[model samples]
Target chain A: MNRFLWLVRREIWEHKAIWVAPAIVIGCLVLLMLTGNVHLGPFTDMSGEAGLGVVPDDLQVKLLVIVYAGLALVVSMIMGIVGFFYSLDALYADRRDRSVLFWKSLPLSDAETVLSKFAVATVVIPMVALGASMVAQLVVAAGGSARFAIEGLPAAAMWRPEALFGGFTVTFLRCLTAMLWYAPIIGYLMLASAWAPRGPFLWAVLPAVGLWIGERVIVGSTFVGDFISSRLFGLYGVLSSRAEAGFEDGEGLEGLRNVDLVGSLRDFYASPELWFGLLAAGLLLLGAIWVRRYRDETS
Target chain B: MGELIVARGLGKSFGSTRALDDVNFRVESGRIVGLIGPNGAGKTTALKALLGLTRFEGGLSVLGLNPHLQRHRLMQDVCFIADVAVLPRWIRVSQLIDFVAAAHPRFRREICEQFLARSDVRRTSRVRELSKGMVTQLHLALVMAIDAKLLVLDEPTLGLDILMRRQFYETLLNEYFDEQRTILVTTHQVEEVEHILTDLLFIDRGRIVLDAAMDQVQEQYAQVSVRPEHLAAARSHQPIAERQGLGRTHMLFRGADRVALERLGEVGVPSVADLFVAVIQGARA
Candidate 1:
């Protein structure tokens, strides 16, 4: 257990972009908020004697959905962006500099080494994203209350511990769901990173793109293209399909409010595509470990 | 204190080229064995096979474990500093210690810290910021701290200056090696290690040509110089190799009676370098 933790720590040490990149993005968002750049004019515009028209009676419910989901969306998306580059570089950098030799020289097996890296991309980084999102949301909430107090309105309702804590809890669950759902993609990028002689991104992406193009041109079929799109965009499909089924036709926001991840995750695991994608990921992850184990450093 | 390594018919090929071919040897505990070979003689390949870094075709065992099949378990007792500098340059000195302690079950942290304390290497300094010699010192310190039974060094001082190179071997000999441990070292600078080795294995073209105790090398091979007039008599002994310098012909004789060679002219025990050349030439002949 400690061994695996150290390996993950090593990954964090080497890839500063993991925390540094998201931190910078969050810093910029905060900076914008502080500088009065986020007016929320369209969302908050109102005219009333007490100026409380900006926040309606159902404003807390709406804000709960919007803030939590928006923060979760922003953080998870930015994490995915960072994860793409991180997974691409993870296995490649060690071999490029011949640190693989040093790493393999340790008593740990190749499986342990590669799996820790996979865990970093899929599991650890997502939790970090979740934490970043929660922190950012809290800061923004604090700012919102500060602005509300400056105008002599009641701010306690907006900063209620229960609502804010519930928002954070919901976002955590969402991030966990999204990252697990995205594991196959993470595994693929890491496989490419492990095996590519150079330019791992090209190695990973070109084959998929070329195959998609070839399938479209040669077979006149959208199967492969749709499969790729489904993997890329399937989280929303998984979340919304059940949500849409549960609610009335035009009630997406309300359906989204009822995103029951545990029940939905059960459905997610039942999907044939999910099983197949995960199987493929398992095979590729094994290949990555095998490559790390057997490939000679000098070559 | 028994046989620590045994390899037989060990073979490996890289594409059309065989890097190690039908190699066989054994290393006993408490001995320092020098694997001396010219470039492309399968020295690195054989070392890699022994270290479990590569797969082989035939029977090979290190510390009673199949090196390739049970590499992770084998690594607990075996350590190596390859011919190249392999420490990741991005890590800090302290982080490197922390990592080794975490990854290796047998690694002792205080020993590593103790070793580091004797040097000027700062705990916070990145490997990239250190001089190459300092990096090697740091590497030696880490390797020494590990309680491994067999240490394999493939040209461990390949790029260091003379003083540091000498220091590397000194540290290995004085600080690391013990009656319970074994050391297998490979080097192109044979002369530097020649005096320290208890046994020598000279290889060429992917095969080991000479495997003998250093004392046996003294008893089995003799270098002699004969006058032009006595050359015919010296040739009767069938020298393994011959060289002409300063109007005298020097012959390297394998398994010849040293007393007989002394009768021809001046007879002496050949250096490891001379024996390496003669053995390779003799194999060709």
Candidate 2:
């Protein structure tokens, strides 16, 4: 575990681009918000016809809150972008540079190597981006609010700690859980990087696509479509388990309004499936280790 | 510690082609062994197998551990520098050093920093920005920082000029290497490294053709330059390899005395390159 920490730390220290990536994202978001105009539409029904020229107070407040929340998700996803590159390429870069030999020579095992990569790719990178995004979000929100005030229009709910940090923590945990649950995907990527000769990414993704296509061709089914929908809509087995727990506990959104962040974490922890996902993630991580041990580093 | 590395009938195949076949050798601690072979002799493949970077079908052990099974634990005592150009392009020299310090228990950060003063490599520049020679030196600096029982180098001085290559090896000898540490070096330019080598393993087409002490090989092989009149007699002894040089014919033969060769012509010890060529052709035959 100590060696794994050192490996993860070394990866972070070398990748200066990760530190710079979020700043670029936050800066772009701020630039967009400051120059663009915002709309509230109608206060009564958010989906109703637009009541032009007279923005009701309630309608304006909801729109402001909704837009800010949407922006937060955008920022969160953008911040999480490093995961794809970092996790997918983590094993590859070392082998490419032949540094795997150096690292392997240092009493670090293949299992440790793969797990540290998984932790960095899925856990640590997001945490770093989350912290960076929080700071940048504050700056963007403040600047946009002041600019709106200068134009004599009321700024959106830029200072709602409830909507920003509260939502971010829960969503970040959800993203983390989702990434953990899909550990097999990341494991396959590691395997691809270890074995495949020419195209690691393509080799990793193409088989899943081919299986999806083959399944459809054989059964006239839509498993891939359903799978995509489930991932995006949060209707996977983990989510279903959480829903069941939510039913038993009756704690859905109760603490959301008060921004009792710890309460929200408690609710998240209530699901037994999170532990199950973690265990499965561990197994998949072991599989990655097995593959990397026999992997030809030159390949 | 009696055996630093041991391999018995180690073999690796890729699809239909065999990269390594029935390779068997051992090295003791405190020796600088040279692994020399032609381009396709599987020198790199054997090194990878010893390091546990690739899985093979036969017996392999390093420091009493199966490299294939306990690579990480094995790595604790072994340091490797595959190529000088392999340091990450995005990292600075200082960051690489700091990273090694954090990652490896045996890495001597102070020694690395001290060597930095003598190296022409900049501590702050990104690896990709440095010239090829500088990159090799930077890599050497990092690997030298680690205190390990074994160091495996595959083409360690590649892409560096003569001066830089000399500096690199000199630093390795002065700061890092000792009687307790063993280094397995593989390179095409054997003459450059021949002076420091205590042992030699000559590989050809995935097989070890010659594994002997450097002194023993020099003692047993002789180079003879004979006139056309003596060529017939010299040819009778079946030397390892033969070639026609300017105004004379040079041949490499295995024998202590040139008594038999006196009937053929004049005899002397050939250069390492000539010996390498002769040994390779002999192995083929």
Candidate 3:
């Protein structure tokens, strides 16, 4: 276990983009908020609905909750992209520089090395994104409270403790589910990194794209295409489906408030696709370990 | 002393070209064995097999453990420097030290730090920022700190200057080597390592042509600088290789009677460089 932590630290030391990318995004967001460039168009429209040029206290709290959630989503997206590039580069970089020889000279096993990369992609990256998002949320809330006070509105509306707590809980759960959902992808990228002699990113993407095209040309079916799309966007599909179901009553924003984020995540966890994805990820990770063990540097 | 490494019928091929073919040799503890060979002679391939960096055929063992099967376990007792300048270019010197200390159970950080303190490598500088010689110094520092039984080096001073190469071997001998440790090194610079090598293993065309102790080589091979009148006599003794330089014909013979060669002309033990050439050429012929 101690060795594993060191391996993870080594990965972080090598791949600074894991945290830097999200931090930069959050920095930009905070800068924009502080500069008064954030135009609350939706908040103004909601206030217009009240016919008093002032948003109701309850509606204002709801809007703040939505703002916090939106920041988390944007930061998580940047982290996801960072994780993608990181996985592609992790195993291949050592071989390109011939540092794999030095790394292999140590007493760490191939399984430990490969799994540490996997853990960074799946777990560490998401946690960093979540942590950055939380900081962004606090910054936005504090800034929004100042704005509300300067505008002579009640600042307490921006500090709905229960709603803010719920927003953080839902974002944390979403980050957890996103990591589980994306495990196979992280594994596949790492497998390519381990196996490809050069241009690992192309190796990881071209094969899947080629397979989708081959299936389209030969079978006149989109099964492969659908499968790829479902894997890539399936988590959002689950979330949106539950969201749309809540909107069946035509509640709009109120409907979003009623959407059970935790329960939808529970449904995602229970799906056969998630379990099968995990299994496939396990096999791909095993392939990575095997490739790393037997693949010679010269080859 | 026990055998530190033993290989029998070891074989490896890249596509159709054989890099190692039916190679057999053993390294005993407390010996510095030089694996001497020309380029494309399978020196690196054999070392890679022993270090578990590549796959091969036939039986092989290092410290009684299968290198390919139990590489990580074997690494605890064995260490290798594949070549100079192979360290990661982006890592800071301090991070590299920390990593080795954490991963290698037998590594002593204080010893490594002490070695580094005497060199010009800065702890905060990335490897890429350092010169090639400094990079090698850092690599040697890390490897020398590990308390391993066998150390394999493949051209460890391949690109360094003369002074650095000399210092490298000097440090290895003075601080790292002991009675309980064994070193297997391969290099093309025969003269630089000749005096330090306790044993020599000459390989050619994917096979070991000669394997003997230094003393055995001294006893079995002799070179005679023959006068023009005695050239026929030296030739009759069946010299393996003959060269004319500085108005004298030097003939190298294997297991030739030293008294007979002394009677022909001035005789002396052949240098390793000369012996390696004679042996490789004889095997080819």
- Global lDDT of each model? 0.82, 0.71, 0.87
lDDT of 1 by residue, B134-183 (tens): 88888888888899999999888888899988888887888888889899
Q: Ten-residue segment with the worst summed lDDT in candidate 1 chain A?
A: A40-49
Best model per lDDT: 3
Q: What is the lDDT of residue A12 in candidate 2?
A: 80
lDDT of 2 by residue, B1-285 (tens): 688898899898878877788989999999999999989789999998888788788999899999877777878888888877667777777777877787788888887877777768888998889998888777777778888899999998888889987887777777778989999999999888888888989998888988988788778888888888888777778777889988889888897466877666777767777888888887787
Q: List per-model TM-scores for chain B.
A: 0.94, 0.94, 0.98
Task: Name the 10 consecutive residues with the lowest summed lDDT in model 3 chain A.
Answer: A44-53
Docking class of 2: medium
Off by over 4 Å in 2: A1-3, A13-17, A32-68, A96-99, A140-195, A232-280, B227-229, B232-238, B256-266
Q: Report the error of model 2 at residue A228, Å.
A: 4.0
Off by over 4 Å in 1: A41-43, A47-56, A151-154, A237-272, B225-229, B245-248
Instruction: Please report how far candidate 1 places residue B58 from its true position, in Å.
Output: 1.3
Docking outcome class, model 1: medium
DockQ for the candidates, in order: 0.68, 0.60, 0.88
Model 2: residue A66 alpha-carbon error in angstroms: 4.9
